[model samples]
Target chain A: GAGVSQSPRYKVAKRGQDVALRCDPISGHVSLFWYQQALGQGPEFLTYFQNEAQLDKSGLPSDRFFAERPEGSVSTLKIQRTQQEDSAVYLCASSLGAIIRSKNIQYFGAGTRLSVL
Target chain B: DQQVKQNSPSLSVQEGRISILNCDYTNSMFDYFLWYKKYPAEGPTFLISISSIKDKNEDGRFTVFLNKSAKHLSLHIVPSQPGDSAVYFCAAQHNAGGTSYGKLTFGQGTILTVHP
Candidate 1:
Protein backbone atom coordinates (compact mmCIF):
# COMPACT_ATOMS: atom_id res chain seq x y z
CA GLY A 1 0.00 0.00 0.00
CA ALA A 2 1.19 3.51 -0.72
CA GLY A 3 -0.11 4.73 2.64
CA VAL A 4 -1.83 3.46 5.75
CA SER A 5 -5.37 2.22 5.15
CA GLN A 6 -8.09 1.58 7.71
CA SER A 7 -11.40 -0.26 7.48
CA PRO A 8 -14.98 0.65 8.44
CA ARG A 9 -14.52 4.38 8.16
CA TYR A 10 -17.63 4.79 10.30
CA LYS A 11 -19.04 2.46 12.94
CA VAL A 12 -22.11 2.84 15.15
CA ALA A 13 -22.13 0.43 18.04
CA LYS A 14 -24.60 0.01 20.84
CA ARG A 15 -23.47 0.20 24.39
CA GLY A 16 -21.84 -3.01 25.66
CA GLN A 17 -21.31 -4.30 22.12
CA ASP A 18 -17.93 -5.30 20.83
CA VAL A 19 -16.28 -3.59 17.90
CA ALA A 20 -13.18 -4.40 15.94
CA LEU A 21 -11.21 -1.80 13.97
CA ARG A 22 -8.63 -2.80 11.44
CA CYS A 23 -5.52 -1.07 10.10
CA ASP A 24 -3.34 -1.93 7.11
CA PRO A 25 -0.07 -0.09 7.19
CA ILE A 26 2.20 0.78 4.31
CA SER A 27 4.12 -2.14 2.89
CA GLY A 28 7.57 -2.78 4.41
CA HIS A 29 7.09 -0.11 7.06
CA VAL A 30 8.53 -1.43 10.30
CA SER A 31 6.64 0.80 12.72
CA LEU A 32 2.89 0.87 13.44
CA PHE A 33 0.96 3.06 15.90
CA TRP A 34 -2.65 3.29 17.05
CA TYR A 35 -4.27 6.34 18.59
CA GLN A 36 -7.63 7.50 19.93
CA GLN A 37 -9.03 10.92 19.17
CA ALA A 38 -11.94 12.40 21.02
CA LEU A 39 -14.04 15.19 19.57
CA GLY A 40 -12.13 18.46 19.49
CA GLN A 41 -9.00 16.80 20.80
CA GLY A 42 -5.70 15.42 19.62
CA PRO A 43 -4.95 11.81 18.89
CA GLU A 44 -3.83 10.09 22.04
CA PHE A 45 -1.35 7.23 21.74
CA LEU A 46 -2.83 3.78 22.26
CA THR A 47 -0.33 1.16 21.21
CA TYR A 48 2.68 0.57 19.00
CA PHE A 49 4.21 -2.35 17.13
CA GLN A 50 7.65 -2.86 15.72
CA ASN A 51 7.39 -5.88 13.48
CA GLU A 52 5.30 -8.53 15.30
CA ALA A 53 6.36 -7.49 18.75
CA GLN A 54 3.87 -5.45 20.76
CA LEU A 55 6.61 -3.78 22.74
CA ASP A 56 4.59 -0.91 24.26
CA LYS A 57 0.90 -0.99 25.05
CA SER A 58 1.00 1.17 28.13
CA GLY A 59 -1.32 3.69 26.56
CA LEU A 60 -4.25 1.30 26.24
CA PRO A 61 -7.02 2.82 28.36
CA SER A 62 -8.13 -0.43 29.84
CA ASP A 63 -7.70 -4.21 29.81
CA ARG A 64 -10.70 -4.50 27.53
CA PHE A 65 -8.75 -2.91 24.71
CA PHE A 66 -6.54 -5.26 22.72
CA ALA A 67 -4.42 -4.87 19.59
CA GLU A 68 -2.32 -7.24 17.55
CA ARG A 69 -0.07 -7.24 14.54
CA PRO A 70 -0.01 -10.94 13.80
CA GLU A 71 2.09 -10.96 10.63
CA GLY A 72 3.83 -7.64 11.23
CA SER A 73 1.80 -6.27 8.33
CA VAL A 74 -1.84 -5.70 9.31
CA SER A 75 -3.18 -4.93 12.73
CA THR A 76 -6.51 -4.97 14.55
CA LEU A 77 -7.86 -3.03 17.52
CA LYS A 78 -10.68 -4.73 19.38
CA ILE A 79 -12.79 -3.11 22.04
CA GLN A 80 -14.89 -5.31 24.29
CA ARG A 81 -18.11 -4.14 25.95
CA THR A 82 -17.75 -0.79 24.34
CA GLN A 83 -18.91 2.20 26.31
CA GLN A 84 -20.21 5.58 25.27
CA GLU A 85 -16.82 7.10 25.98
CA ASP A 86 -15.44 4.86 23.24
CA SER A 87 -17.15 6.98 20.63
CA ALA A 88 -14.33 8.66 18.75
CA VAL A 89 -11.98 8.29 15.83
CA TYR A 90 -9.43 5.51 15.92
CA LEU A 91 -6.29 6.32 13.97
CA CYS A 92 -3.47 4.12 12.74
CA ALA A 93 -0.11 5.32 11.48
CA SER A 94 3.10 3.77 10.21
CA SER A 95 6.59 5.12 9.77
CA LEU A 96 9.82 4.02 8.14
CA GLY A 97 12.05 4.02 11.15
CA ALA A 98 12.37 1.30 13.76
CA ILE A 99 13.18 3.76 16.52
CA ILE A 100 12.59 7.38 17.43
CA ARG A 101 15.92 8.74 16.14
CA SER A 102 15.42 7.37 12.68
CA LYS A 103 11.66 7.73 12.57
CA ASN A 104 10.53 9.53 9.49
CA ILE A 105 7.18 11.24 9.20
CA GLN A 106 4.36 9.11 10.54
CA TYR A 107 1.96 8.65 7.68
CA PHE A 108 -1.60 8.36 8.96
CA GLY A 109 -4.63 6.65 7.50
CA ALA A 110 -8.14 7.96 7.30
CA GLY A 111 -9.29 6.76 10.70
CA THR A 112 -12.34 4.71 11.64
CA ARG A 113 -15.06 6.68 13.38
CA LEU A 114 -16.66 4.62 16.13
CA SER A 115 -19.91 5.93 17.52
CA VAL A 116 -21.03 4.20 20.69
CA LEU A 117 -24.57 4.99 21.66
CA ASP B 1 -0.23 13.23 34.57
CA GLN B 2 -0.35 14.91 31.18
CA GLN B 3 3.32 15.01 30.32
CA VAL B 4 2.39 16.94 27.21
CA LYS B 5 -0.07 19.82 27.41
CA GLN B 6 -1.67 22.26 24.98
CA ASN B 7 -3.58 24.83 26.97
CA SER B 8 -5.23 26.64 24.12
CA PRO B 9 -8.39 24.98 22.92
CA SER B 10 -8.86 27.10 19.84
CA LEU B 11 -7.43 29.99 17.86
CA SER B 12 -8.83 32.16 15.09
CA VAL B 13 -6.59 33.91 12.60
CA GLN B 14 -6.74 35.64 9.26
CA GLU B 15 -5.56 33.63 6.30
CA GLY B 16 -2.61 35.84 5.47
CA ARG B 17 -1.38 36.32 9.01
CA ILE B 18 1.09 34.15 10.84
CA SER B 19 -0.44 31.59 13.20
CA ILE B 20 1.39 30.59 16.29
CA LEU B 21 0.51 27.42 18.24
CA ASN B 22 2.17 26.51 21.49
CA CYS B 23 2.85 23.35 23.50
CA ASP B 24 4.60 22.44 26.73
CA TYR B 25 5.98 19.21 28.09
CA THR B 26 6.99 18.21 31.58
CA ASN B 27 9.48 15.47 30.90
CA SER B 28 13.00 16.67 30.12
CA MET B 29 13.91 13.23 28.82
CA PHE B 30 11.86 13.78 25.71
CA ASP B 31 14.33 14.13 22.89
CA TYR B 32 12.02 14.91 20.00
CA PHE B 33 8.83 16.89 19.39
CA LEU B 34 6.39 16.72 16.49
CA TRP B 35 3.39 18.68 15.28
CA TYR B 36 0.54 17.16 13.30
CA LYS B 37 -2.30 18.81 11.38
CA LYS B 38 -5.63 17.02 11.06
CA TYR B 39 -8.63 17.65 8.88
CA PRO B 40 -12.24 16.80 9.63
CA ALA B 41 -12.62 13.49 7.82
CA GLU B 42 -9.00 12.50 7.37
CA GLY B 43 -6.20 11.35 9.58
CA PRO B 44 -3.61 13.77 10.85
CA THR B 45 -0.77 14.68 8.50
CA PHE B 46 2.71 15.19 9.85
CA LEU B 47 3.32 18.90 9.40
CA ILE B 48 6.76 19.39 10.95
CA SER B 49 9.08 18.09 13.59
CA ILE B 50 11.99 19.29 15.77
CA SER B 51 14.62 17.24 17.55
CA SER B 52 15.97 18.39 20.89
CA ILE B 53 19.43 18.86 19.43
CA LYS B 54 18.20 21.83 17.38
CA ASP B 55 16.27 24.83 18.66
CA LYS B 56 14.69 25.63 15.33
CA ASN B 57 13.78 23.71 12.19
CA GLU B 58 12.20 25.19 9.13
CA ASP B 59 10.48 23.54 6.19
CA GLY B 60 8.82 25.86 3.80
CA ARG B 61 6.31 28.05 5.67
CA PHE B 62 6.35 25.88 8.76
CA THR B 63 8.88 26.41 11.51
CA VAL B 64 9.15 24.76 14.94
CA PHE B 65 10.97 26.19 17.92
CA LEU B 66 12.01 24.31 21.05
CA ASN B 67 12.91 25.89 24.37
CA LYS B 68 14.27 23.35 26.81
CA SER B 69 14.48 25.82 29.64
CA ALA B 70 10.78 26.74 29.56
CA LYS B 71 9.78 23.18 28.70
CA HIS B 72 7.94 24.65 25.75
CA LEU B 73 7.74 24.30 21.97
CA SER B 74 5.84 26.17 19.33
CA LEU B 75 4.78 25.89 15.68
CA HIS B 76 4.65 28.89 13.43
CA ILE B 77 2.91 28.97 10.07
CA VAL B 78 3.73 32.07 8.09
CA PRO B 79 1.00 33.55 5.90
CA SER B 80 -1.51 30.98 6.98
CA GLN B 81 -4.01 29.70 4.50
CA PRO B 82 -7.58 28.50 4.91
CA GLY B 83 -6.37 25.02 4.06
CA ASP B 84 -4.18 25.17 7.14
CA SER B 85 -7.20 25.30 9.43
CA ALA B 86 -7.22 22.11 11.43
CA VAL B 87 -6.60 20.67 14.85
CA TYR B 88 -2.88 20.68 15.59
CA PHE B 89 -1.38 18.20 18.03
CA CYS B 90 1.99 18.32 19.72
CA ALA B 91 3.76 15.13 20.64
CA ALA B 92 6.87 14.17 22.56
CA GLN B 93 8.80 10.92 22.78
CA HIS B 94 10.61 9.68 25.88
CA ASN B 95 12.89 6.66 25.64
CA ALA B 96 14.59 6.19 28.95
CA GLY B 97 15.31 2.56 29.78
CA GLY B 98 12.18 1.41 28.09
CA THR B 99 11.46 -1.38 25.65
CA SER B 100 9.57 1.00 23.40
CA TYR B 101 11.46 2.51 20.53
CA GLY B 102 9.06 5.30 19.64
CA LYS B 103 6.27 5.84 22.09
CA LEU B 104 4.60 9.22 21.61
CA THR B 105 2.76 11.09 24.32
CA PHE B 106 0.42 13.68 22.92
CA GLY B 107 -1.52 16.61 24.37
CA GLN B 108 -5.07 17.70 23.82
CA GLY B 109 -5.03 19.48 20.47
CA THR B 110 -5.46 23.16 19.72
CA ILE B 111 -7.85 23.84 16.89
CA LEU B 112 -6.68 26.51 14.44
CA THR B 113 -9.13 28.26 12.20
CA VAL B 114 -7.69 30.35 9.39
CA HIS B 115 -10.54 32.39 8.01
CA PRO B 116 -10.20 33.76 4.54
Candidate 2:
Protein backbone atom coordinates (compact mmCIF):
# COMPACT_ATOMS: atom_id res chain seq x y z
CA GLY A 1 0.00 0.00 0.00
CA ALA A 2 1.07 3.58 -0.55
CA GLY A 3 0.34 4.40 3.08
CA VAL A 4 -0.39 2.66 6.34
CA SER A 5 -3.54 0.52 6.40
CA GLN A 6 -5.52 -0.75 9.39
CA SER A 7 -8.51 -3.01 9.90
CA PRO A 8 -11.19 -3.66 10.85
CA ARG A 9 -12.10 0.00 10.64
CA TYR A 10 -14.46 -0.51 13.57
CA LYS A 11 -14.84 -3.16 16.22
CA VAL A 12 -17.50 -3.79 18.88
CA ALA A 13 -16.52 -6.08 21.72
CA LYS A 14 -18.44 -6.91 24.83
CA ARG A 15 -16.81 -6.51 28.18
CA GLY A 16 -14.64 -9.58 28.92
CA GLN A 17 -14.50 -10.44 25.20
CA ASP A 18 -11.33 -10.39 23.15
CA VAL A 19 -10.52 -8.38 20.03
CA ALA A 20 -7.71 -8.03 17.57
CA LEU A 21 -6.75 -5.07 15.36
CA ARG A 22 -4.50 -5.28 12.36
CA CYS A 23 -2.14 -2.83 10.67
CA ASP A 24 -0.30 -2.90 7.34
CA PRO A 25 2.46 -0.34 7.21
CA ILE A 26 3.88 1.34 4.16
CA SER A 27 5.94 -1.01 2.10
CA GLY A 28 9.51 -1.36 3.36
CA HIS A 29 8.93 0.81 6.39
CA VAL A 30 11.19 -0.55 9.09
CA SER A 31 9.50 0.98 12.11
CA LEU A 32 5.92 0.32 13.20
CA PHE A 33 4.08 1.78 16.17
CA TRP A 34 0.75 1.36 17.95
CA TYR A 35 -1.12 4.05 19.83
CA GLN A 36 -4.36 4.31 21.75
CA GLN A 37 -6.50 7.44 21.57
CA ALA A 38 -9.38 7.91 23.94
CA LEU A 39 -12.27 10.18 23.17
CA GLY A 40 -11.10 13.83 23.17
CA GLN A 41 -7.50 12.83 23.75
CA GLY A 42 -4.42 12.56 21.55
CA PRO A 43 -2.99 9.22 20.59
CA GLU A 44 -0.87 7.62 23.29
CA PHE A 45 1.97 5.28 22.45
CA LEU A 46 1.28 1.62 23.17
CA THR A 47 4.29 -0.09 21.67
CA TYR A 48 6.98 0.13 19.00
CA PHE A 49 8.54 -2.40 16.67
CA GLN A 50 11.74 -2.20 14.71
CA ASN A 51 11.06 -4.70 12.00
CA GLU A 52 10.12 -7.88 13.92
CA ALA A 53 11.70 -6.76 17.19
CA GLN A 54 9.43 -5.37 19.88
CA LEU A 55 11.59 -2.54 21.08
CA ASP A 56 9.27 -0.90 23.57
CA LYS A 57 6.03 -1.83 25.26
CA SER A 58 6.16 0.40 28.30
CA GLY A 59 3.13 2.49 27.41
CA LEU A 60 0.74 -0.45 27.27
CA PRO A 61 -1.77 -0.06 30.11
CA SER A 62 -1.86 -3.70 31.15
CA ASP A 63 -0.62 -7.20 30.50
CA ARG A 64 -3.76 -8.07 28.59
CA PHE A 65 -2.71 -5.78 25.73
CA PHE A 66 -0.36 -7.59 23.39
CA ALA A 67 1.16 -6.66 20.01
CA GLU A 68 3.29 -8.48 17.51
CA ARG A 69 4.87 -7.96 14.11
CA PRO A 70 6.10 -11.40 13.31
CA GLU A 71 7.19 -10.89 9.71
CA GLY A 72 8.37 -7.28 10.10
CA SER A 73 5.48 -6.01 8.04
CA VAL A 74 1.95 -6.74 9.19
CA SER A 75 1.22 -6.14 12.87
CA THR A 76 -1.60 -6.98 15.21
CA LEU A 77 -2.78 -5.65 18.56
CA LYS A 78 -4.83 -8.08 20.59
CA ILE A 79 -6.67 -7.21 23.74
CA GLN A 80 -7.86 -9.98 26.01
CA ARG A 81 -10.81 -9.50 28.37
CA THR A 82 -11.80 -6.11 27.03
CA GLN A 83 -12.98 -3.46 29.43
CA GLN A 84 -14.99 -0.32 28.90
CA GLU A 85 -11.92 1.73 29.61
CA ASP A 86 -10.21 0.02 26.69
CA SER A 87 -12.61 1.55 24.23
CA ALA A 88 -10.68 3.86 21.98
CA VAL A 89 -9.26 4.30 18.50
CA TYR A 90 -6.19 2.21 17.99
CA LEU A 91 -3.82 3.83 15.49
CA CYS A 92 -0.87 2.30 13.70
CA ALA A 93 2.02 4.19 12.16
CA SER A 94 5.11 3.34 10.14
CA SER A 95 8.35 5.11 9.43
CA LEU A 96 11.71 4.69 7.84
CA GLY A 97 13.52 3.46 10.90
CA ALA A 98 16.98 4.64 11.93
CA ILE A 99 17.17 7.06 9.07
CA ILE A 100 18.37 10.45 10.24
CA ARG A 101 16.61 12.20 7.38
CA SER A 102 13.21 10.81 8.32
CA LYS A 103 13.80 11.05 12.08
CA ASN A 104 11.01 8.54 12.66
CA ILE A 105 8.45 10.84 11.12
CA GLN A 106 5.46 8.49 11.14
CA TYR A 107 2.71 7.91 8.62
CA PHE A 108 -0.55 6.72 10.17
CA GLY A 109 -3.56 4.64 9.25
CA ALA A 110 -7.24 5.51 9.59
CA GLY A 111 -7.26 3.46 12.82
CA THR A 112 -9.59 0.88 14.29
CA ARG A 113 -12.37 2.29 16.43
CA LEU A 114 -12.93 -0.20 19.22
CA SER A 115 -16.02 -0.01 21.37
CA VAL A 116 -16.48 -2.13 24.49
CA LEU A 117 -20.04 -2.72 25.56
CA ASP B 1 1.99 12.21 34.24
CA GLN B 2 0.85 14.39 31.36
CA GLN B 3 4.21 15.46 30.06
CA VAL B 4 2.66 17.39 27.20
CA LYS B 5 -0.35 19.65 27.70
CA GLN B 6 -2.57 21.56 25.28
CA ASN B 7 -4.32 24.03 27.53
CA SER B 8 -6.89 25.22 25.03
CA PRO B 9 -9.71 22.81 24.36
CA SER B 10 -10.99 24.75 21.40
CA LEU B 11 -10.26 27.83 19.29
CA SER B 12 -12.40 29.73 16.81
CA VAL B 13 -10.95 31.63 13.88
CA GLN B 14 -12.32 33.39 10.88
CA GLU B 15 -11.28 32.35 7.44
CA GLY B 16 -8.22 34.24 6.18
CA ARG B 17 -7.21 35.04 9.74
CA ILE B 18 -4.38 33.43 11.67
CA SER B 19 -4.92 30.60 14.11
CA ILE B 20 -2.53 29.86 16.92
CA LEU B 21 -2.47 26.82 19.22
CA ASN B 22 -0.24 26.35 22.21
CA CYS B 23 1.30 23.33 23.97
CA ASP B 24 3.56 22.92 26.97
CA TYR B 25 5.65 20.03 28.19
CA THR B 26 7.31 19.25 31.52
CA ASN B 27 10.00 16.99 30.17
CA SER B 28 13.05 18.98 29.24
CA MET B 29 14.56 15.96 27.57
CA PHE B 30 12.28 16.34 24.53
CA ASP B 31 14.40 17.34 21.57
CA TYR B 32 11.97 16.94 18.74
CA PHE B 33 8.49 18.50 18.46
CA LEU B 34 5.78 17.92 15.86
CA TRP B 35 2.23 18.97 15.06
CA TYR B 36 -0.49 16.72 13.68
CA LYS B 37 -3.95 17.45 12.29
CA LYS B 38 -6.79 15.00 12.45
CA TYR B 39 -10.39 14.72 11.37
CA PRO B 40 -13.04 12.65 13.07
CA ALA B 41 -12.72 8.93 12.29
CA GLU B 42 -9.27 9.40 10.82
CA GLY B 43 -5.77 9.28 12.17
CA PRO B 44 -3.59 12.32 12.51
CA THR B 45 -1.54 13.65 9.63
CA PHE B 46 1.86 15.15 10.13
CA LEU B 47 1.95 18.94 9.87
CA ILE B 48 5.43 20.24 10.61
CA SER B 49 8.21 19.57 13.04
CA ILE B 50 10.91 21.57 14.78
CA SER B 51 14.02 20.29 16.46
CA SER B 52 15.23 21.73 19.74
CA ILE B 53 18.34 23.06 18.03
CA LYS B 54 16.21 25.66 16.27
CA ASP B 55 13.33 27.68 17.63
CA LYS B 56 11.25 27.88 14.49
CA ASN B 57 10.24 25.95 11.39
CA GLU B 58 7.86 26.77 8.61
CA ASP B 59 6.05 24.89 5.86
CA GLY B 60 3.52 26.44 3.52
CA ARG B 61 1.15 28.55 5.64
CA PHE B 62 1.93 26.66 8.87
CA THR B 63 4.69 27.63 11.25
CA VAL B 64 5.86 26.10 14.48
CA PHE B 65 7.63 28.02 17.24
CA LEU B 66 9.39 26.37 20.12
CA ASN B 67 10.62 27.92 23.37
CA LYS B 68 12.89 25.51 25.11
CA SER B 69 13.31 27.73 28.12
CA ALA B 70 9.58 27.68 28.93
CA LYS B 71 9.00 24.16 27.64
CA HIS B 72 6.38 25.55 25.28
CA LEU B 73 5.66 25.16 21.59
CA SER B 74 3.00 26.62 19.34
CA LEU B 75 1.58 26.23 15.83
CA HIS B 76 0.43 29.13 13.72
CA ILE B 77 -1.71 28.86 10.63
CA VAL B 78 -2.05 31.95 8.48
CA PRO B 79 -5.23 32.45 6.48
CA SER B 80 -7.02 29.64 8.20
CA GLN B 81 -9.30 27.54 6.02
CA PRO B 82 -12.46 25.71 6.93
CA GLY B 83 -10.89 22.50 5.67
CA ASP B 84 -8.19 23.00 8.26
CA SER B 85 -10.67 22.85 11.07
CA ALA B 86 -10.02 19.72 13.08
CA VAL B 87 -8.21 18.45 16.16
CA TYR B 88 -4.59 19.47 16.34
CA PHE B 89 -2.12 17.71 18.57
CA CYS B 90 1.45 18.44 19.57
CA ALA B 91 3.92 15.62 20.06
CA ALA B 92 7.43 15.37 21.43
CA GLN B 93 10.21 12.82 21.14
CA HIS B 94 13.45 12.35 22.99
CA ASN B 95 16.43 10.12 22.31
CA ALA B 96 16.61 7.65 25.17
CA GLY B 97 20.27 6.89 24.52
CA GLY B 98 19.40 3.87 22.42
CA THR B 99 17.14 2.63 19.61
CA SER B 100 14.05 3.23 21.70
CA TYR B 101 14.08 6.92 20.82
CA GLY B 102 11.28 6.45 18.28
CA LYS B 103 8.64 6.73 20.99
CA LEU B 104 6.52 9.89 20.90
CA THR B 105 4.53 11.57 23.68
CA PHE B 106 1.50 13.54 22.58
CA GLY B 107 -0.65 16.31 24.05
CA GLN B 108 -4.36 16.06 24.71
CA GLY B 109 -5.21 18.09 21.56
CA THR B 110 -7.01 21.31 20.60
CA ILE B 111 -10.06 21.58 18.41
CA LEU B 112 -9.86 24.39 15.88
CA THR B 113 -12.79 25.74 13.94
CA VAL B 114 -12.34 28.15 11.06
CA HIS B 115 -15.56 29.76 9.99
CA PRO B 116 -15.98 31.70 6.84
Candidate number of the best lDDT:
2
lDDT of 2 by residue, A40-96 (tens): 888999999999999899989999999999999999999999999999999999998
Candidate 2 docking classification: medium
User: What DockQ do the predictions score, one after another?
Assistant: 0.69, 0.75
Instruction: Kindly list the per-residue Cα lDDT of model 1 for residues A8-102, writing each as its tens digit.
Output: 99999999999999999999988899999888767788998888889889889999899999999999999999999999999999988654464
Candidate 1's C-alpha lDDT?
0.89
TM-score of chain A of each: 0.95, 0.96
Clashing pairs in 1: none
Maximum-TM-score candidate: 2
Q: Residue-wise lDDT of candidate 1 within B44-110, one digit each (tens)? A: 8888888898999999999999999999999999989999989999988766745555767788999
Question: Residue A37 in candidate 1 has what lDDT?
Answer: 85
Cα displacement (angstroms), candidate 2, residue B51, comes to: 0.3
